[model samples]
Target: MLQIYNTLSRSKQLFKPIVPGKVKMYVCGMTVYDFCHIGHARVMIVFDMVVRWLRASGYEVIYVRNITDIDDKIINRAIENGEPISALTKRFIDAMHADSDELGLMHPDQEPRATDYIAKMQGMIGKLIENELAYQADDGDVNFAVRLFPNYGSLSGKSLDELNAGERVVISGGKRDPLDFALWKSAKPEEPVDTRWKSPWGEGRPGWHIECSAMSCELLGEHFDIHGGGADLQFPHHENEIAQSEGALYGKDRKLEDAPFVNYWMHNGHIRVNEEKMSKSLGNFFLIRDVLKSFDPEVLRFFMLKAHYRSPINYSDAQLEEARAGLVRLYTALAQVTLSQAVKAELTDLQNPWVMRFTQAMNDDFNTPEAIAVLFDLASEVNRTQGDEKLVLASTLQSLGGVLNFLQRDPTSFLQSGTKDEEGLCPAMIDEQIAARVAAKNAKDFAQADSIRKALLAQGIVLEDKPGGITEWRRA
Candidate 1:
C-alpha cells in the first residue's frame, strides 16, 4: 500500500483512495499578480511527483489547482502598470504555464479559475447566508462570521480569542468580529476594472477564500481526498477554506458522517535565500524566470528534491551547483548501464532490492531525498555490474528511474549540453586551468603557467596533476 503524509492528521497514513482507484485533489494555485517563483514551483512539482507516483502505482488521480486570478494584489499591480486587470492577470497566467512547463510539472487534472466560477461562488455564499454561516454588511460586503463556526480554528489550531487580522485582512463594516473573512467585497467606485457582479446584495466580487471553496466543490465535489498548498497557507487562507468547505459539508441535507472538506492535507515547507526568508523588503526575491535564466530549471527541481518536502530548503549558488552536479552524477550513472543486449524485456532480480528500498522510502511518506539516495545506491550497484549479465536488470532500473522524472538524460549529455556559459562560476573549469598551470610548471615555463593557473584559481577551479602526467580537475 502507498503511504503519504497527511498534514491534517499530523501522521503518515496508508493512501487508500476514497473512491478506490480515483483520487480527487485540490491545491491552491498562483495568485496571478506576479511571475511565478521558486516558492511556487516547489508546491507545483511536489504535487506533480505525488501524482506521478500514484499513477505509477496504479491509481487514477484527478488533481485540481485553482488560479486565484482576482485578488487585491492583482488589482493593485494592474493599476500601477496602467494596464487592465484582465490583461495583467492573463500575462501572469501564461507566464506561470510557461515556467511550470519548463520545470516539467504535469498540468493539473483541472485548472480552475476564480473568475470562471463566479456564479458558483455566489450560490455558496447564499447558502452560507441562509444557514447563518455568513452575513451581509451595511456597505454591501458579505463576511463569514468567525464565532458561528465552532470548527473555525480546526485547521490552523488557533481560536477566535487569539487570532488577529493583519495586513492581508480587509477592513469592513459587515464583519461582526475582526477575525471574520470576506465572502464578498463591494467594488470601489473607481476600481478601474469591473470587479463586481450583480449579487443579491449589490454589484461586488467574491472574496479570496470563497473562490477556492466554491470552485473546488463545484469541480471536484463537496468533499475531496486532499487539499495542498505552501506552509504559509496553513493560516487564514487554507484554514478558512477548511471552515467554509467543512461547514458546507456538515450542513448538507444528506448528513455525511465524514469530514466535510478533505480527507487529506499536504503542505510543503518554506524556502529561504541567504538564510533569510525570501521577501520583497530584502530585495532578494527571485522570480522563477529569473532563476531559470541562470540555471537549468531541473537543477532547481533537483535541489528541491534534495531536501525532505517538509524541511525548509535553504538556497544559494553553492547549493545550486551541488544540485546540478548531483543530478549529473545520477544521470551519468544511469546512462553508463548497458541495456541494448537484453534478449527479452525482463527486469533482473537485482532491480528488486532497489525497488523495494525506493518504494519503502517513498511509501514512508514520499521521502524523495531518501528515495534518491536509494537510487544513487542502485546506480552504484548498476555501475559495478555491466554486460548482458546486468542487461535486463539495467533496463528495468532505467525505466523505473525514469518514472522519478529526474533520471532520464544521459549524465554526459545533460552536463555537456554546453549549458555552462560565462555565467555560474564553474569549479571544474577552474580546476582545469590549475592543471594547465601545473603542466606549464613541468615544462619549466613556471612564470607563464603560474599566471595562467592563478587566473583560473581566481575563478574557483582546482586542478591536480599526477607524476604520471595525468590530471584530474574538480570545482573548488
Candidate 2:
C-alpha cells in the first residue's frame, strides 16, 4: 500500500481513495502568460510521476491539471503586445505543450481551461452570496467573506489574526474584512471588452482562486482524493481554495469538518539556483527551453527525480552534468545486453527482487531517489552477469525504469545524442576522433593519442577505454 505525505495533515498517511480502486486528483497548472520556467516544470513532472505511480499500482486515476488562460497576467501581456487575449494565451499554451512533450510529461486526463467555466463560477458565487458567505462590494467586485468561514486559514496553518497582522493595509474596496479575497473582479475600463463577462457582479471576470474551486468541483466532484500544486501556492491560493470550495459546499452553517474538500494535499518544493530560490527578479530563473539548449530533455527529468519531490533541488550546470553522466551509466549497462523476447516475457514477474525493491521505494511517498538507486544496483548486476542472466537483469532494469518514465529509449540513440550542445562536436565527429586515437595508439604514437583525449575532454566529453581496446565516450 502507498503512503503519501499530506500537506494538510503535515504527515505521511496511508492513501485511501474516496472510491475503491479509483483516484480523482486536481493540480493547479500553469498561468499561461509566458514560457514555463523550471519551477513550473517541477509541478508538471512531479504530478506526472504521481499519476504514473498510482496507475502502476492498479488504481484508475483521473488527473486534471487546469490551465489559467484568462488571468490578469494574460490580459496585461496581450495589451502590452497589442494582441487578443486568445492569441497571447494560445501561443503560450502551445509552448507549454511543446515544453511538456520535451520533458516527457504525459498529458493530463482533463485540462480544463478557466474561460470555459465562467457560468459555473458565476453560479458558485451566487450560491455563496445567497448563503451570506459572500457579498457584492460597492466597487462591483464580489468577495468571499473570510470572517464568516471560521476555518479560512486551516490549509495554511495560519490563524486569521496572524494573517491579518501580516497583511498590508490598503483601501478595503468595500470589503467588510481586510483578509477577504475576490471571488469576481469588476472589469477595468481600459481592459479589452472580450475579457469581461456579464455576471451578477456586473461585467467582470472570475478571480484566480474562484476559477480552481469551480473547475475542480465541477469536474472532479465536490470532493476528490488529492489536490496539489507548488509549495508557493499553499498559502493564499490553495488556502483560499479550501475556504471557498468547502464554504460553497456547506454554506453559512458549515463547520470545517462538515465535509472534506480534498482528502490529501501535496506540494512539490521549489527549484533553487546557487542556494537561492529561482525567480525572474533575481535573474537566475531559467526557462525550460533555455535549459534544453544544453542538456537532453530526459537528463532534466532525471535530474528532478534524483531529489525527493518534497525537498528543494538546486539547479546548476554541474548538477545537470552529473545527472547526464548518471544517465549515461544506466544506458551504458543497457547497451551491453539484448532484451530478447524470452527475457522480456519473464519481466512480468513482479516478485523479482529488483522490481519489489523499486515498488517499495515508490510506495513510500514516491521515494524516487531510492527507487533510482535500485536501478543503479540492477544496472550493476547487468554489468557483472553474462548471457541469459545478464539479459534478464537488463530487461528488469528497463521495466523498472519504465515505471518512472525513464530508460525506454534505444540505448545507442540516447548515448549518441551528445547532450544537445549546438557548438560541441557531434557524435560522428567524436567517433572519428576516437578512431584516430585508436589508430595512433596502434601505430605507437602515444603522444598523439593523449592529445586527442585531452582535446575531447576539454569540450566536456569523457572517453572511457575499455577491455579489448574498445573506446566509449559521453558528455560530462
Candidate 3:
C-alpha cells in the first residue's frame, strides 16, 4: 500500500482511490507561452513518477495533465510576435513534447487543452452565477464571490483577514473584494479578435483558474483522486479552483466537507537558484533545452529526483555533474550483463530482499531517495557477483529503474555516447584513440599510452582499463 503526503491534510496518509483498483489524477500542466524551464521539469518528472508507481502497483491509472494553451501569456506573446495565437501555442506545445521525449517522460493518458473546453467553462461559470457564487461585475467581468465561500482560504490555510493583510496592491478592476479572482475576463477593445470568445459574460475569455476547474471536472468528474501542481499554485490558483469547482457543484449551500473537489492535494516544491526561487524575472531560470545542451536529459531527470519531491531542489552545474557521475555508475554496473530469459524469470521472484526493500521505499510516500539507494545497493551486488546471478541482478536493477523511467538505454551506448565533445571527437574517433592506446600498451610504450589517456581526460573523457585490455570511456 502506497502512502502519499496530502498537502490539504498536511500529513502522509494511505492512498485509497475513489474507485478500487483505479486512480484518476489531474495535474496542472504547462502554460505554453515559452519553453519549459527546470521548475516545469520538476512537475513533469514528479507526477510521472507517481503515475508509473501506481500502474506498477497493479492499479489502473487515468492521468490527465491539462495544457494552458489559451492564457494571457500566450495571447501577449502571439501579439508581440505578430502571429496567430494558435501558431504561438503550437510551437511551444511541440517544443514541450520534444523536451518531454528527451527527458523520457510518459505522456499523460489525456492532455486536455484549455481552448478545447471553452463551452464547458462557460457552462460552469453560468452555474456559479445562477447560484450567486459568482457575479458579473460592473465592468462585465465575472468574478467569484470569495466572501460567500466560507472555506475559500482552506487549501492555502490562510484566513480572509490574513490574505487581506498580505495582499499586494490589488488590481482595481470591478472585483467586489480584493481577494476575489476572475472567472471570466471581459475582452478589451485593443485585444486581438482571436483572443475573445462569445461568452455569456460578453465577448471575453475564461480566466486561468476557471479553465482548470472546467476541464478537470469535465474530464475526470467533479471529484477525483489526486490534484497536483507546483507549490507556487497552492495559494490563489489551486485555492480558487477548489472554490469555483465546489461552488458550481453544490451551489451556494456548499460546505468544504459537503462536496470536495479533490481528495488528495499534492504539491511538489520549487526549484531554486542559490536558495532563491528560480524565475524568469530574476534571470535565474534555466530552460530545459538550455540545460540539455550541456547535460544528458536523463541526468537532469535524476538530478530532480535526488531530493524528495516536496523539498526545494537547488540547481547548479556542480549538482548536475554529480548526478551525471552517479548515473554513470549505475549504467556501468549493467554494461557487461545482458537480460537473458533466465534473468527475466528471476525478476518475477518479488520475494527477493532487494526487490522487497525497493517496493517498500516506493510505497512510503514515493520515497525516491530511498528507492534510489536500493538501486545502488543492487548495483554493488551486481558488481561483486558473476555469471547468471549477476545477469539477474543487472536485470532487476534495470526493471526497477524503468518504473522511474531511467537506466533503460543500452549500457554501452549510454556510457560511450556522453562524451563532452561529440563534434570534436566522435565515438569512432574515441574508439580509434583507445585502439592506439591499447596498441601502445601492447608494445610496452607506457609513455605514449599515458599521453593518449591524458589527452582524452582533458577533453572531458574518462577512460577505464578493464582486466582484458578493454577500455571504457564516458564524459566527466
Q: Which candidate is the best by TM-score?
A: 3
lDDT winner, 1 or 2: 2
Clashes of 1: 5
Tens digit of per-residue lDDT, candidate 1, span 1-476: 66778877678888877798999988899899988878898889888888888787677889899999888888888888999878999999999999998897889989988999999988888888877788888777888887887777766666778777844667666677888889999888878755667888788888999999998899888878888898888878888888777665564232435646888888999889978887667877778888887678778888888788888988787898898778766665555554444333222233567667777777777888888887677667666786764565556556666656776565444655423454645556555666677778788998988688666556554444546765544343
Candidate models: Cα lDDT each: 0.76, 0.88, 0.87
Name the better of 2 and 3 by TM-score.
3
Worst 10 residues of 3 by lDDT: 164-173
**What would the per-residue lDDT of candidate 2 be over residues 1-476, giving only the tens digit for each residue?**
79999998899999999999999999999999999999999999899999999988889999999999998878999999999998999999999999999898999999999999999999999888888899888988888888898777877787888885222123455788888888998999999997999986789999889999999999999989999999888888888898889888887677645658899999999899989998877988999999999888888999999999999999998999899889988999998876655255233356788877888899999999999999999999999999888888898888888888889998878877775756889888999999999999999999999999999999878888878878878765
Strongest candidate by lDDT: 2
TM-scores of the candidates are: 0.86, 0.93, 0.94
Q: Which residue pairs in candidate 3 have backbone atoms (N, alpha carbon, C) closer than 3 angstroms, thus clashing?
A: none
| Candidate scoring better on lDDT of 2 and 3 | 2
- For 4-97, candidate 3 gives per-residue lDDT tens digits of 9998888999999999999999999999999999999999999999998888888999999999988777888998999999899999999999
Question: What is the descending TM-score order?
Answer: 3, 2, 1
Off by over 4 Å in 3: 164-170, 255-257, 345-350, 419-424
The Cα error of candidate 1 at residue 185, in Å, is 0.2
RMSD of 3: 2.2
Error in Å for residue 51 of model 1: 0.8
Q: Which candidate order results from sorting by lDDT in descending order?
A: 2, 3, 1
Tell me how candidate 2 scores on lDDT. Answer: 0.88
